[model samples]
Target: MDGHPLRLALDLLKGTLALTVHKIRYGLASRLWHGTNLVTEQMSRHTQQVRLLRAGEVLGSLDVSTVRDEIGSRRGTVSFNGCLHQLFSGQPLTRQEKALVLAQLVASFSLTTSYDFADSPLLDGDDRLLMREVLYGAGFAAREMRTFIYQSRQDGQDTTADIESKSTREQTRSATRKLEVVDVSLDEFIRFHDANLAQKHNYRRWDIDAAFVADALALGKARILAARGRSADGLTPQGIQAAMIYTWDDISLKLYRISYDTAKTANPHANKVLIARGMQMAHDLGLLLDTDCAPPGAAILYERFGFPERVRTHYVRATLLSKFAAFIRRDFPSLDRRLRPWVIRAVTRVNRSAA
Candidate 1:
């Protein structure tokens, strides 16, 4: 199973080292998490190196054949291990609760993706297989269940790794956002991401479990948005957790979840803009990233496609009006209060793509 499709699908984590996803940078995770930012940058990167360790498909760009030689090959600002955690940690574990624990803990359970190497004390023999079965079910839908990955700044290091080989040109980076928990149907996830994905960059496949979604939905651990109908949706935000987000390559970059700090602003749009601005601050600090398992532009690309400037808007009642009021009141809160407009939870033809 060394070069098996599943093993090759994605790069595994290195050892038991902990991972930190910038909440502001991701989707599902962002909603559930409230405070505490493990990552210091606003951007991250991925690669086409690894493959689906489960299916033996060329899920990633970094293949086993070149493992040893590129173990620490510097990409933009990320590493193979870092990128693996970024993508892996975003997946839902049980879907039982809005924020499941097993899924997030699983991120650190095994650094490597193994086949026939089953010894996860977390799940016994039967339970282990059952877990895989659920993951497999989610894969069958073939819907985009947030396939991207990310890394937080290391203890003292600005952790946005990048893809830059000694002999090749370096990949570009983007503003990073704090990582957070978010959830959505594979279709909406895909559509929201692909619609705005740039032609120049893209992420590799993950041979993700087809049964994962059905299992999650059946377990009632999390909620999956319907492909055809929904006036609105919700999710959690904060701390270490597994979450999903639509990849930028998907065409429906709308309807993705976001974490809003009510204290940040009364006007919703500006609040979102502030989040984007914060991510840009992280990126400006030289925190963009890239790694071996994914293509050269993975990390920063994730943040870029999810940037506020490029957000996919959807109508949120008075958000249309409150957004304007927020803008007018950005400087003079007291004055704006008298003129402040109310925000009602409603829907209309607003841009669906926003962080």
Candidate 2:
């Protein structure tokens, strides 16, 4: 039998009667109201149907009810899925609305990182501009220096780290190429670095990886100072010469440089020595404690510099970086809102943090 309309009407009537009777017996036990036996049975069946069927299925079902209830009875309304669908398409989004969504998606979730400096030479042109900015730092005259990463062993790590990347804004790359990893220090920042000032890269202002490297370099010197300080066994001459050059390289491959003004020079081990010296200096300056790395950024170097007694016996949680993602997403409506503003912020912040 075609019971569709009749079923809906019956369900309606059942709902109306249940609401009316329930009001009169507000505090009474549910069993005390078995008086409206048919209506009560219908309510049970309707509730079961609601539990078993999806919104669309329920609306399409013929077994719901047949009796039409008086107008204005308590009842369920149809569910809407179209709006939810549009939300995920990234077609368009209202800022506050999307912010609300993002907040729910990433509430307290931690994020990890990696970075790149494009994948082609400037001549080849696949995002070649990425080549320029990154190269400018490693070029004959680099202002400051830092490093980047392109996928590495991420197996079971707390905060996988990488520098931010750059893509040539205009033009395209002629062919695919590998990403370049680098080490960088800003030229503007160099002037402020002096014996009197604390390690200038505030952990809060830079990418997490840089902070670790910076922290490692900071803790490295002191332990060494107590034992070797620039003695023969300490930061090999090769590494020392290399450290003389400020660095910035592609995330995929490492970069090392030593040049005098506009003239280019090469001393491969110089960078290694320089990095080692930087670490030793960090310790010498007391910017970081020797026991910091088992927590995972700069501690091991401290021990390597000569603090064997320093055992980070217990694990320490990472609060290392500036916690950028969540902070930016906090006020947004959705965690994944792909609006231009949010996307731009995510892109800029992610690159800065990674870089």
Tell me each candidate's TM-score: 0.19, 0.18
User: What is the per-residue lDDT of model 2 for residues 20-128, given as tens digits with 9 covering 90 to 100?
Assistant: 4433332223213321111112322221111111121211111111110111111221111000111122325354333322222111111221111122111233222
The number of the candidate with the highest lDDT is 1
lDDT of residue 188 for candidate 1: 51
Q: How far out, in Å, is residue 223 in model 2?
A: 18
| Stretches > 4 Å off in candidate 2 | 1-185, 188-266, 275-340, 343-355
Q: How many residue pairs clash per model?
A: 132, 76
Whose TM-score is greatest here?
1
- RMSD of every candidate to native, in Å, equals 24.2, 27.2
lDDT of model number 2: 0.24
Q: Which parts of model 1 are misplaced by more than 4 Å?
A: 1-184, 204-211, 224-355
